[model samples]
Target: MRTLTLGTPRLTAGLDQHHRVDHTAHRELHGPLPQLGADDLITLAGLGSLRGRGGAGFPFARKVRAVQTSVLRRDSTARVVVNGTEGEPGSVKDRMLLTRAPHLVLDGAELAARALGSPEVVIGVADEGARAADPVLDSLRSAVDERGSGTVFRVVRMPDRFVSGQAGALVQGINGRVPLPPGTPRRTSESGVAGLPTLLSNAETYAQLAVLAIGGADRYAQEGCASQPGTVLLSVSGDTVVETAAGTRLSRLLSACGLSSARAVLVGGYHGAWLSGEEMSRARLSRDGMSEVGGTLGAGIVLPVTGDTCPLGETARVLRYLARESSGQCGPCVRGMPALADSFVRLLSGEGSPEDVLVAAGIGEGKGACAHPDGSAVFARSALRVFSEDLSTHSLTGGCSRPVKGELPLPDGYDTPAHPRLLVDWSRCDGHGLCAELLPGLVQLDRNGFPEEPDIPVPGPLEGDAELSVRMCPALALRIRAPEPGSAR
Candidate 1:
């Protein structure tokens, strides 16, 4: 990767070797700064839809307004937390900034702290690799040593689980509470860290803020799209991994990094969607334009689904992994994800029928505490839209017979248990087989009498005796899927 790229196109120009915190370009996080005048930050954010790098794609304006409002209104103490914790796999942009450009992220955090009258600033990060975390922390320490009275900013080590970085969970952990989101829509802006109004955002988002603080709006807007005038960092991975001999040139590397040519791009990490490896038609990468095509800017990690990889099978495996990642906090998500995974696995094997698709969409829809389930559903549904030809072949053949080559996704290991399904207490199961009757494609019956669903996606369109068999089962073990992401029509 290019260690120092400046004034380039996309969200990466400001990035140094470090992904999350790039302090090399900025001066210090400060001993303190002038309190932010109302509306100063709103302008500093470029007064545009500069989207947050975090997958939520929240507007920077809204965040500024929230902090701006809190500053203008609330009386108690307020704080800022630069959330460097990346719970999602395939995400390393933040780590890059933290390890290499620590100063920049700290500057942004410090700016927010000073602007919002937040005396305290906490940088929360959890690393998947030990080696990556220390450099980031050390860089942070140096920034602090240069400014703070040795105490203005703090870096907190968060729990390693994927669930830890969640806003509510992060608040809970900092406060010595459990690291889990509350069941309600309680805002972190209301309570954070330890009972203080907090302005918290992903590490990369803060890094962008620092970039804006120093570079000014004109420099930042130079190469970006008119809508989202900024560059982004993407972690590019390709099939047929190539390690060059000592003589590999920079240009060849850039091409491989996806600066040239067209291929399926996995944006926003795993929760992102796949784009057709169309022509270089997609000349630049940004937010709104990608969404117009059913994709997101994501967390800025772009993994290429190269030609050699079977996009279908790879998508199937990712769906399954994301399904398991569900926190199981909500009834729809916990129950629906497994069903969605099963439906895709079936489609991969060519066993999925028409009825299966409908139910999978139903189960995986808006049922989760967060948008994870809905996002995964969007991924699956879009994959079906893009790969209808593949689906047709699988339907005709009764199975893809492709051996599920492990491409298009990182290895999640083999033998992971199939996510659990809704079960019927046979004692409660009235033999009415309501479940089998309701979702016949999903649930069948064994000899003795119980719903038996193949651990795969049930294709849409089922009928006849097999359908009748499930219909007879009264126990309703056969709940259909939720409406699924982006599938209301």
Candidate 2:
């Protein structure tokens, strides 16, 4: 990944010369880490109006204050968690920080631990295995050794699924449980990671904090807009990571990355909303700016698609991937998401109405265990709005006659499983027993005639039957898919 800077660099100060900045080099570039107490750090964050860069854009000061309050009330020591799990496929800023600027992230994490009176600091990266060869895990481990700070830092691997980066889910993964969000919502500041008050934020957020600490609030506030101070990192088109001031024009950043124009830009990641070229040209890279453009700087992902590809087709592909990536713990996500994806696919094929997509998108709004459903809804709705021209073409003429270029990227092992399996989309399935009859060895029908197992891996001998069943399903709900990224084959 190439790193570029628009203005003066803070978190990415020394990255131009060094691939990975070590502790000694980091100190030389940024100067020594300043010692600050809990109140001081919180005050500094408030002065800069720092907010978490992990998509939510919550005020960092409020989170620290809430954790401190919980610590005192519970009479418990807090735990500091640095969430480095950048599960959004289009996002790589956090991973880049963890790999190329490990010390900066560690410095911020250590400062938070010291302020919160916590001895344990946990850094959660996506599960690339426990092997020391992993770049992110290795860089963090080496940095911890070099710092030799009094506080203990433990780097743990988290599931690399899309929703695994949720604050609650990250905490749960650090606790060694399944890295999925809890059914009932709970605040990490109150009880997290072994039921202790936790100060958890994304990797970039902590790196930004370290930048704040080194430069003080005044210097940090000098670069970006008054509302949002300091530089923000953006993962653009999955190839370039740019560190630019908060209010930098979106068009300028795209030009810097060699993208002069586009039909639509996906501001944020898959769960984020889409923006037409006009909106993209007028947009800024801040929270308020993105809101004005009817989007969010979700995980700082900026992806643009030119007119060569069908925008609706691209959106449908992403929606389908998002539907498959659901945690499958709630009705809204498991059932509603597939329906949403189906609606989009049908629209893309000119076999469904726009109302179908709208209704399906609303099925999961405000109703999932996590924000996946709502965010997916936002993405779908925005696509419908931004790509209305493309929608009309597809609806009237059976398509725009343009192919899906797959401009939006999915992770390598994303739907491509090592083993092929039979999967069902419950939203379209109507107690169909045709699959069960065709592939009795691989599928079984329950009393309701629905497949007893929604998902089943196809054996080598049963591949033929699986194919026949998939082709013969009356509702067109059965499909043969490879194992998803985190699923067991």
Candidate 3:
């Protein structure tokens, strides 16, 4: 990823020339990490009004205080987690920090550990497997060894799935469990990672802390908006990571990325809302600014939708991907997501109404174990509103002239060639023959009137029928699982 800056770069200062700033270079560039106690760190954070660069924008000082309280009350050591799991396909700022400027992130993490009196700092990066090794992890490991700091640092690989970056999921993965949020919500500050008070924040948040520690509150607040001082890292259109002071206009960032025009801009990632051209002009690249324009600077993703592509079609593709990416631990993932994806697809093809899309978008709004459902709903609804004209054309006469140009990015192999296979949740099957009747060619009823050859891959011609079978099943036992890498077809 390329790096750009709108103003004097702090986090990205030395990144322009250096491929990876080693410990020696890092020290020279930013000076040594300053020692700070818990109270001192909290004071600086409060002064800066620092918030998690992660999607939530939670107050950093509040999180620090929470972890401190938990530690004092339980008499337990706190763990500092540097969440570099940039799972949102639209964002790469965390990865940039880890790969290009690893020491900055480490300095921040180490500083936090020292202040909190924590013995260990855990940094989580996406596990990309053998196909592509994450250099970020390697850089982090090397940076830790180079520092030779007293603080113990462990760099661990996490699943690259979208929801795996959630605080609970990250803690769960570090604890050797599946990296999915627990069914019941729990605060990581209160009890996280080995049942101890944990201070977990996005990687950039930690880097910002290091910046604050080095520059002090006054210098840190010199740039950016007064409300939220300091610079923010944005993954502009998934191609460039730009570090700019807070409250920069959205148009300036887009122009800096060489984007001259766009029909609309998808602020934040898939979970974020879309701003129309008009709204985009007025949008500011800050938390409050985004909210004022009915958007969020979620994870600092800014993607523009140019006129060359059909926005509705692009949204349908993303909705389908989000539906597939769900953790499958809640009703939203198991049913609502697929239904919403199907509705959007139909809408894109001009076979379904906008009402269908709206209703499907609301299926599991506040009922999921995580915010995935709510975020997906927000994304879908924003698309409907921003692309109302294109939606109207599609609803009236099928799709528009433009084809589905994939301006938005997904991970490698996201478009894997695989057929949809029928999966039967036997617990809910109840031996209903509705599936077999709906997909006569793809599914067959056995002696018990349950689906036979449930593992069979539906033929391309019958994939539609297979989906229909799933939707029509009275028991809601049938689902279509997309083919995985080594799954039997």
Q: Rate the local accuracy (lDDT) of all candidates.
A: 0.60, 0.85, 0.84
* lDDT for each residue of candidate 1 in 217-286, tens digit (9 for 90 to 100): 7867664566776566554552221222111222343476545553455655676776665512452456
Q: What C-alpha RMSD separates each model from the true structure?
A: 8.9, 6.1, 6.0
Put down candidate 3 lDDT per residue, 1-489, tens digits, no spaces.
Answer: 789988989999887788888889888888878888999889889998999989999999999999999999998889999999888988889998988898888889989899998889998889878856667877877887887758898877897888889899999999989898899999999989898999999999999999999988999998799778989899988888999999999999888888868889998899999999889899888998999999999889988889998888788777767766777656555567766877887886689988997898788899889998899999999988888898889888877899777888877655442246678887888886877666653465789887765565443435777788888888888888876663210
- Prediction 1 TM-score vs. true: 0.75
List clash counts for every candidate, in order.
63, 1, 0
Q: Quick one: RMSD of model 2?
A: 6.1
Let me know the TM-score candidate 2 reaches against the reference structure. 0.86
My TM-score estimates for the predictions, one after another, are 0.75, 0.86, 0.87
Model 1 regions lying over 4 Å from their true place: 1-38, 46-49, 127-133, 146-151, 238-263, 401-405, 408-415, 420-489
Residue-level lDDT tens digits of model 2 in 416-470: 3223668899999998588866765346678888887887655333567778888
**By lDDT, is 2 or 3 better?**
2
**Whole-structure CA lDDT of model 1:** 0.60
Candidate number with greatest TM-score: 3
lDDT value, candidate 2, whole model: 0.85
